[model samples]
Target: MVLTLTTFLLTLLSIPLLQKLYTLFYNAFLHPLRTFPGPPYVWTDWYKCYNDVYLNRNWTDVLKELHEKYGDVVRVGANELHFSNPSVYNDLYSPTHRWDKDGALYRVFNQDESSFGYLTYREAKARKDILAPLFSHRATCEMQGIVKKHLDRMCEALGKREESSDMLFALRSFSLDCITTYCFAKDVHASSAEDFKHPLVEAMDAAVPAIRVLQYFNPWRKLVFGLPPWLAKLTDPNAGARVELQDMLLEQVKEFVEDPKRMEQTSNPTIYHRLLDPSNGPVPSLKSLHDEAMSLFFGGAESSGNVSMLGTWYILQNPSIESRLREELREAWPDLEDMPRLEDLEKLPYLTAVIKESLRLSPSVPVPLPRVVPPQGATLSNHPIPGGTIVGMSLRFVHQSEEIFPDPQTFNPDRWLGPDASSLNKWLVAFSKGPTNCIGQNLAMCELYMAFAALFRRFELVLDGTRSEDLTYSEGFLPFFNPRHMRAFCRPVEA
Candidate 1:
């Protein structure tokens, strides 16, 4: 009887192990992607996580090496294939292809209800359609004042700083304020914090790496993010600001939803106006509003700040680049008091080149935007990829390809100014392409222009011991810079 009972317990445990063994064998020898080449461990499910989370490697860098070894298409997981050839990028992300977003990669953000987090193109489109008007070029042009208001606030704060400011935090703070105010008519005042150490900014800084780790244990993400404000604060005291900001957004969303007439009282039209309007579609649930607010706020702040910070970092390394940028800004504006219109700013060839080069060199969403092949399968790079296979090609592959951009690592804006520069737009997939591209792109473009122009035109900038080493980053949903952040002195130019 004792022996029989022990066998039953052992059998229950071994069942899961046996299932894993069968999966390994099937994935290695009998699965549809069996012909694809990868490291033997790719047959196992946890290898990418091992490389990304456990071994602590930059996953994209690893993909570069693996592509070198195994050619353009490599099976990176049991059902995942990562493509390195830039040719496949256009094919996968083209407007004609409306494949669902790969759930495995996107679920990390835990924003399933937001436009970005919606899996199917149809679902994403519904949300994007409602949100689209607010991000249109016309709308962005009209809303440039909102961006400048926050920029002015940031510059004022910078003027008061007695020492070098944290450029990352400063830019992030500016972006946070812009997004919060622009989206909800609420000023987070992230830029108003002393020396740019806003708690919300700090919490975001703290949250990025944990987000990278959360990929491995997806279910744990719920546990981590679901923690109550007090419990989250108790668990990680720095989370107080993050939780506070989230709670504030939730309250605002709640207030708007419960009494949507409050949207009429806002200084500007908020997302709540469109989202809650019955004509556009059914109003998203309160929880979904909370999710969308967090998604847009964090994504807007992080991406804009990262691109601007990276551009400034590289410019400080190349004084010629900075000189040319300042010269163009000075010419375009003529007087510091009278700034160029967003349209005029877009027309400045050199400024446009600088911005394009910045976007190309440092893609904000550099991760492999994975897409699942449909049930009927698909053809890419002349290879017939199997149905339901999770396939992705990272923007890093497209942006850094030597064939497309010679000497891709160098910060040379001239690349975008060449005679054939008109043709390079297809290769520039920074905001991505297709039906589900970034919904906030026009707004982001507006923010980048304002941020970069202000950084160069309004101040005489100097790096404060921030070297190239400090800018190295590991890939998550976004790039997570390591060791330290970019710091600089922003002495106001005497107009």
Candidate 2:
């Protein structure tokens, strides 16, 4: 009886000591991110990160708040750090010396082994080497006629829509049609009077929201993909949607392979032709080709579409800026019937400023792309961040910095005009910097300039019921301004 009583006494005495041990373990070994100063719960739980991202909440705003409390650089997670100082751009994203693109998040986004967007850095470099010539100025100049045909179709569709119809929906369909035509050598005609009924379009729309969820709560991708098909669907809605999309894409590719003649007939000497021809070098396997086609199709459609839509929305909201932009277009081209050449568009100062301002205000790629620290560790703002750390610079934070851009919230295109505009232009890292930056940036710019100049010159846009500042943004793999929530009233301009 005496021995049992002694054992009970020892057990009771050890509870506080065990609690202290647990805390020590968390601080020293188990918690690799403990040194970062973020929200109290962020270190202990990842759900905190998801909650902020999933709701379309600006985590950059949270980072700014932390920076206010912790200074220019702060540890925001156990193994994550954020640097708001613009100087960090040189260290983080500069071409001469920069981190590689093997981050866990990037790997998760790669849909297949053969997918161009999913390839490793070395493989990507190789792919870029092969593909670079296709996107060159010479190539774009050759393809201008093909692009213009689609833009003409888009303008006709816009003309038929009720004056106040959602331009966002119109732009989405236009971009999808343009991209799919470029990829498949055929028109999906998603922007036409007949609504889009294509299986691919339906499957892609369903997949986007699911992909966003996956991105926010990154799971063990291999384990997730390894599960039984039914079990995987039950656990991950994105997996099901992805499967459906992949099947449709594969079928489309099979059709192309079966009828090489069809591809030849429809081909306009595009990137698709280059990718399919062995003479062009390293033609991907059928599966890889499908993955790449889908990647290019979706990336081109979504990113460019969102930017064009937002640029339109921003111009509509700021009338003075819009008027100035219209004046510039008028002065440069003067004839709406004859489309401005690429060289002509380049010389329009106010048009370029308006585009710059739009990109600054509503960046389609708003989030900071995460980069893994190198083996030797890295320095940001003179602070030594340990190796294996996940570091990023938020576009939202950098573009909106009061130091870099005074009156940052206002849509002021004038900031990009005049002599001092050169200084301000240096900080506009919308497409990011370095070799890993967007490959389709030039194409995107050309499309935007054409679409904006065409639409604004033909129609006058007015906000129907939505206020510019109050417009909602849909959060997913990429954030797009919610068009369903925005109602714009348009009226034809007198020629």
Evaluated with lDDT, which candidate comes out highest? Answer: 1
Model 2, C-alpha of 276: deviation from truth (Å): 4.3
Q: Model 2 lDDT vs. the true structure?
A: 0.67
**Would you estimate the TM-scores of all the predictions?**
0.97, 0.83
Backbone N/Cα/C clashes per model = 0, 1
Model 1 / residue 261 / CA error / Å: 1.1
lDDT of 1 by residue, 137-175 (tens): 999999889998998999988877779999988998998
Candidate 2 lDDT by residue in tens digits, 1-495: 999999999999999989876875675456655655566655543533555655556566567788888777766655677788887865787776546554445655554643335534556666666667766767766666666788887777666667565666566666776666655666766666443323444445555555455654566555654577678678755457456555666776776667755566766654556666667676678867776766677777766666677788778766787787888777877776787887678778888888888788765765667777777986677877778777887787778878888899887888887678898876788777776676666767777777788878877777767665546664455664543545565566766
Worst 10 residues of 1 by lDDT: 475-484
Model 2 spans > 4 angstroms off: 1-36, 45-50, 53-56, 110-116, 193-207, 220-248, 252-263, 276-281
- Candidate 1 lDDT (Cα, 0 to 1): 0.87
